[model samples]
Target: MKRLGVLLISLSVIACQSEKKTTGQTDSTNAGTTSSSLTYKYDSLQVFSKTTTAIDKGKADTAYAKIVYPIFSNEQLNQLVEKKAIDAAGDVDSEKPKTYKEMAASFVEGFDSVNGEPDMGQPGAWFLDDQTKVLVSQPDYLCLEHSNVSYAGGAHPNSAMVFWNFDPKTLKEITLESLIKEGGLPELNAIAEKIFRKNEKLSPTASLKDSYFFEKDTFSLNRNFTITKEGLKFLYNPYEIKAYAYGSTELLIPFSELKALAKPNTLLSPTP
Candidate 1:
């Protein structure tokens, strides 16, 4: 089941301000004689700052950040999620940030340092909005999806989406290799290419050289995928396999089609 929505309340002070919000939920399910449950919570951290000169001139030379991430009952899982969330929020400094607050503060501080000088003639405000949500939670696997959008005086904003699958019991990241049998990627890629071609309305023998960005115009599956009730859904973020104008692409391959490739007793196994 899905979690509750976040309640946002912004507070302002002088030229810089910070705020936070939190929401949570619990879910349960039954299998024959056994029962299972999971509890998930989310918190949002936001920070905003603007250059004094821009503030005086009524122009916007600002830096802002907002991150919504999960808080799990398991400490190790929490740490892993936090680190990945911070990385997704654009932690480009030499020293990595340990927490959301540090990540946001460093973002604003970098803006201040660069725009603090007089007559900097900055173009526009910079922002990073990163959010993580539960996509699927089961007894064996839990998947979290992260969506991000940001801009720093560019012609257009940049966006990305990523999925993180975890072993619920071990709290460790799950890889596509573990889900598929040995020497199965070739067959899987063939299946995905057929679906992709149909989805894009490209002919069977059409060339991808000039129209797409795949290496040597070859089609392959990326690791950015999540588990769904019907199938495995893969995502190709903007500029991943095509130009930004084309936006993202999604391909859903049903479990029935993957019966031969999927390993036994894994998340990809078809439910009885």
Candidate 2:
């Protein structure tokens, strides 16, 4: 990675939002499950904001980024929700992953380093801005999506997406096993493969080896999944299954497909 010069700046803001699932009738039986009609509200925390800039003669390049995350308002009940996000963001894969605030600072502080001449007479400049979105905000369950875009003197900038799911009542991060039965992996993979083949316009009998996927001969389901009224949607980030040129792969497995494999009394139940 080429280094670019950087400078730092800070900004602050307070925002609040609430989401209530009122489309369906209240179901007392699904109180602990996502099917329950419960309202969820959260407080926002913005930290580690900065702007970095590089200069060459009269021209200058700059980059700015910040991390804005959520904190559940129902502190006593949703403590786990907050803890899980903080831990995951801090534990990101890196030689030394930093906390949410620390990561934001690092991103701006080290936007890019400049040690060489400007490329093609264009002053080196880059910018990245990241934000979080609450996908599912219910009393029992919560899902969040983090999106980021970065540019660093290259052919093109890149963007990445990450998702997080939590069970507020149990204070635990939702996993693949938690949503589907142990025997369901095979079935899920089968469904995903069919969809993938269809999306890629490959013949049913065509072999995956003909594709550009990293594991051309193997079919695998991305671990990142989000809950919804329709079903679970799996997200495969760039390079997760195929080359970045092919972009991300999304697979939506309707609740009906996993009805038999869904755990008992969970959000996987069909919404009425």
Candidate 3:
């Protein structure tokens, strides 16, 4: 588990660079021109990342937790940098952007709340571990994956995944509706369901009840997905489409598969 944590932290700082650059003169007359002439190309992001940890120790009990997440730092490309930095720097705004440290603290607080107080009589330690990384950070898109594993005197440690995609230019989260063209959901859903069934190793005629997926026997695609130069990848976290024992599932729908369905000039379309 420690190795897993180290790998995730190391991944955050790799291959990060600014897309837009200074391209004009320095004179006052050219100052306005400089601001107006700077062009933003679709490529990659300049990222700032930090890891925060918390440890609570008592006479007979102790708890530890940590979190790692990245921040997009291009002013024109991402508007959340300043606010997120402020929150990370110890600002007390409840509505302000949250830092990785804050995320870890919240997890610790929740564990304490649910368990009431640690048992002073127990001689062992309680622990919480969380790690997140940039799965893809490109000029037009960004994908992040978060893994949180924790235990507070439970039968076993539990882990889950959180996936996020955003439009780098506007710094807003992306969704299925934004990527697919009008009337494309039906086609997309049909394709995704077929892939889902195949991944589950069920025959074409097999029913959802044949497996541990949604007790309701419903077949639907998860809204969590990421875009890459090659294709669109949809992810399903534990207990999302199947029992936790079955673990996570990932499906890749290549650009060719969605070529006619995805809206042009969006993340889903093939990059030129």
Candidate 4:
């Protein structure tokens, strides 16, 4: 009777310890699983924010309201967004191997020279000032005058064209090394000079001789970069006034005057 009682007591002790261990493990696991909805809500909000769907500017009315609403609504709940950011401008070309070449986009996309330079179809001119600032106003006529970067490119390693304006005018050029020492636009200025020289050499009309126009300008507002006027030229299509450089000449003819040069009715076929 004594031996059986001893055995029974030992078995009871082992069972109690095992039960205690299992209870402890269960509590720990349940505690780990238990979490506030706040954490889940925050993670969900962050995921929503990172998703970006760009909208085309023209289709603002149809897509704008529906697209942006989700983002604003999600953020208002967590409200812990540290920062928002923007990627680079222009198209993301998948075909292009990732490169700085992305910067080479033309400032004026789809140049339709056929439009006759905007408001000057009758006969107009454009040129550089003595100071070589480009002004595109009719000498006497009133209209908006403006200049925009037409093209830019990264042609070589460590070489890039930040802007190529005005159909690339030609002029004489100096050595890049010398200009650099003179604290010049060693990169952009040198490129412009090259363009001028190239254009001069290629022009079939010798009268369109090469020239140089350069100036250093701090642009408006932020004035981050001091621009150098590396190239400027004069073009005279004499329906209007234009800004141009020295030795600039043009044969100007108004609509009334052009009528004398070539009779339109004789040369052009009348559409039926």
Candidate 5:
């Protein structure tokens, strides 16, 4: 359990670079640039790359990919840096009320919402308090996270956030299941509508997804990945992988491609 929290906070944010020296070769598979010597390409993934029969028959991969692709491919770090968004993502102790450590602790507390319960059996369940942790919209983003936290339990192809990252400080395990998309306010419907329309379905998995509007305007791209039966390995691992963002229309990114997007100054965690 201790190691699990580490997994969730695994991606540690790095210090900002004082001077921006544009170097290194951006990969062609990366969908970000069109003018570079190495251009990336993406054949629009049909709603049913795996299925030829039903629209809803396919996993939420395309819906997930649609948003994720642009985030990774089109993110202009320079723009973000110029606007000082990157520094804000990890605003550190400079924030108003709580310190970074305190804020992180508060997040854990809200996650479990029942951290006091120690004897709970594996203490796991989807969308249920005993089993999920969430990644809510950031300070300036309208994102939210929720999950069943059990790809093992889904046993099905479709799975959202269902992973764990052990946090030793709390001495409790945190699973990726609580971050939901429930409407924060009526206005949030606009965000949900986009997700719904783009998804071409309503309530795809019943997990509560929150408004990511703040993220949409704040970032150029968003990325997320989930490990299901879709060819990646997860069993006996006690962890899962996923990324998400809310930004520009064309900046959606996939998990497979996101690994390449990691910048030197980007937050990274100790690989579990």
Candidate 6:
């Protein structure tokens, strides 16, 4: 189980950098001066291995990992992205992997080492498929989505999806608190709960205690949200607010509903 944890963490780190094509273009105008726009590209890393044993005469245990992440022109932004990816992947020890390639290698090596143990019982081949993509690329915000499916000798494979938002100009993470006005969270949550009920087709006054996992039968907004052209999109992954069998739930709160709660000059603010 410990090795399984390591494999999960390492694979997630490697999954942050997969290959994708992107181009940078400059807009021209009648004026002599030019304004440059920010752009990014992507690269990928992969590692795989299998273990050999003399027991069953050809059933080898295998491990594989793949990762894709974006590369920005700005070095500061690049470093920040790398740091965030590593952090989100989960820490192992003081001497953790420093790059995506190393992370992939670590995952493969960990699985192979565990398989080589003399008394270890054969479970099955293990694999990790991870992908990270630019979900939304706008002038003010950049949203990244990381998703992965993995099996580590558990009862069943697991899948997860995560989103990260960043401020392009400042290279800072765009937190929900940063976009909302002070004392506006209550109103925002109320609006979001209403929409959530509508999306789930639940009556407005329905009790959540029986069917949902809210702490006190009250709905609340989570930080796992992304900014989209249509609205603020939130994702509740499997087992997050419901049983794993229920899968994920998506809630999109329109920008119009959040206009009063949004702070001025932020991405959610309406243009004049």
Number of the predicted model whose lDDT against the real structure is largest:
1
lDDT score for candidate 3 against the true structure? 0.55
What TM-score against the true fold does each predicted structure earn?
0.83, 0.69, 0.62, 0.14, 0.17, 0.80
Task: Compose the digit string of candidate 3's lDDT tens values, residues 79-153.
Answer: 353233333333233433244433344433333333434442233345555544556656666665656676656
Indicate whether candidate 1 or candidate 3 has the larger TM-score.
1
In model 4, pairs of residues that clash are: 127-243, 128-243, 128-244, 139-241, 170-196, 171-196, 171-211, 214-229, 215-229, 238-252
Per residue, candidate 4 scores C-alpha lDDT tens digits across 41-132 of 10110001111222356321100000000011223321211111001222233332121111111111111122223432222111111001
lDDT per residue as tens, model 6, 110-155: 6666776655444666776667777777777778898867676656
Ranking by TM-score: 1, 6, 2, 3, 5, 4
Better of 1 and 5 by TM-score: 1
The per-model lDDT (C-alpha) reads 0.74, 0.58, 0.55, 0.21, 0.25, 0.73
The TM-score between candidate 3 and the true structure equals 0.62
Q: Please, what are the lDDT tens digits per residue for candidate 5 over residues 1-272?
A: 22334323421321111111113344554333322221222222111011111224452211111111112232342232112221222323333212222222322322233332444223223121111212221222111122221111223222333232222222132222221222322332334344444553434444333433333332111123222222111221111211233211222222343233222221221123
Looking at model 2, how many pairs of residues clash? 8
Q: Which ten residues in a row have the lowest lDDT in candidate 3?
A: 42-51
**Candidate 5: where is the Cα deviation over 4 Å?**
1-22, 34-77, 81-84, 94-272
Native-to-model Cα distance after best TM-score fit, residue 144 in candidate 4, in Å? 13
Higher lDDT: candidate 2 or 6? Answer: 6
Better candidate number, 3 or 6, judged by lDDT = 6
